[model samples]
Target: MSDEPAGLVRPDRRRPEPLWHQAEMALRDLIDQGEWAPGLQIPNEDRLCEMLGISRITLRHALRNLEEAGMLRREHGRGTFVRSATMVAGVRGLTSFTDEMQTLAVSPGTRLLLAQVISATREIAEALEIAEGDSVVQLRRLRLGNGQPIGIQTTHLPSARVPGLFEAASDVTSLYRWLKDNAGIVPVKAKEVYRVGAVAAGDASDLELPVGTPAFEVERITFDQRSPFEFAVSTMRADRYEIRSTLYV
Candidate 1:
């Protein structure tokens, strides 16, 4: 809860790396050491600039990069605050929700909302690459972290591919874990798309957000070996979630 800016070393003029990158690294070190805990307001921009012995523009560049990396949050006229470290997913790994939460030291829980066998609609069929009207097992769940609602997840699987899923739905906590243990299916890769969306009434209720609130809509298709086996859509509270991606040339 210290309001003062942590002491920062001035960027080395002789270093080949950019000054902004150096400043960013210095701030990152402070955060990693817990000098600036989550939700703690940082010093004003002028103070930070003076403390780092850098210009305002250079300080802004470093702050912007940290914000994009989910290490800080800036509010209009309210200054900046340290953000809680969040779970990060990259393109190289297919991780389950439980695993992600566990890695972040957050307890994960799931509440089964709906579990039934339904005829695949046009949308579900297209996503799963199945014929319309074919039987599909639909599972709706409320995802929780540390006993707080985080998101709503709905999954569709071809009924023939996962027979008896409905019968074991009540005992399931992690869909990926169940798939591996019961069906011997392991997700090796996935393709996901994300967009900002207005929360629907049902999803809003599950996420404990007001209807029409902004949320993150994530649609994913998971593959076991080379075959697509699961299609899932998750609506997460934008305030509590951050999406991350790594790019390569």
Candidate 2:
């Protein structure tokens, strides 16, 4: 196949959809059809504009949409290139990072950033269904997929419930697995909420993204049986991860 993108056809001006939207969809089709492989720099803006018969502004609008959707990556002083598609996380189950990565046939790794016993603050206590100032095991980790950092998660578990959890595992690849094996506690259900926000400085460094880049802040309270036991906050790279849900009518 040729490296150059196939010729583009000008969109209909009378269509209800905006010209930029049409252009965006057309470009998206090209990417989905594998005309532009991942990591390959696409043609320059001038070329793309000419090919699509659109102005630079319209082409940029399309490119920006794709970039935010994780289908493209634009680097300063370099060029715009195809980005690897984001990994999809189903909202149907309470699955661990390891399980999710395994299902995707990617290697899952974790680097422990912080692990200690600390007093839970009011927010943490409320999330874990414990009293303020109660002891909790705080665990912070960098989640990796295929050796690439994808997210940073911080978890707080009631210390009274899981005594010696930190001491039991020095190198924890999967907290859920360790909890099951050691404490016989398996999270059966969880209530999770997602919001979009700017990346924090520390998290941006760990996730290797620019500070203030868009991120998905996921807050989850996991339960064993009917009692909440673990509360976690995860900052995931929006460009590399997406949350998917299946709705039944």
Clashing pairs in 1: none
Candidate 1 lDDT (Cα, whole model)?
0.83
lDDT of 2 by residue, 1-249 (tens): 344466444677888999899999888778777877788888899988777788999999999878765677789999999878566565446888899877654578899888999999999988988899999999999988768888999999988888669896466778888888877889999898999988998888889999999999999999998589899999998877886556999
Per-residue lDDT for 1-249 in model 1, tens only?
Answer: 254445555678689989899989888778877887889898888988877778899999999878876678889989999987543343335888888777555678899999999999999898888899999999999988768787899999998888778899999988888888888889988998999998898787778889999988999999888578899999988877676676789
TM-score of each: 0.69, 0.68
Which stretch of 10 consecutive residues in model 1 shows the poorest summed lDDT? 84-93
Which portions of model 2 show Cα errors greater than 4 Å? 1-85
lDDT of 2: 0.83
Evaluate all candidate structures by whole-model CA lDDT and list the values in order.
0.83, 0.83
Measured with C-alpha atoms, the lDDT of residue 195 in candidate 2 is: 94
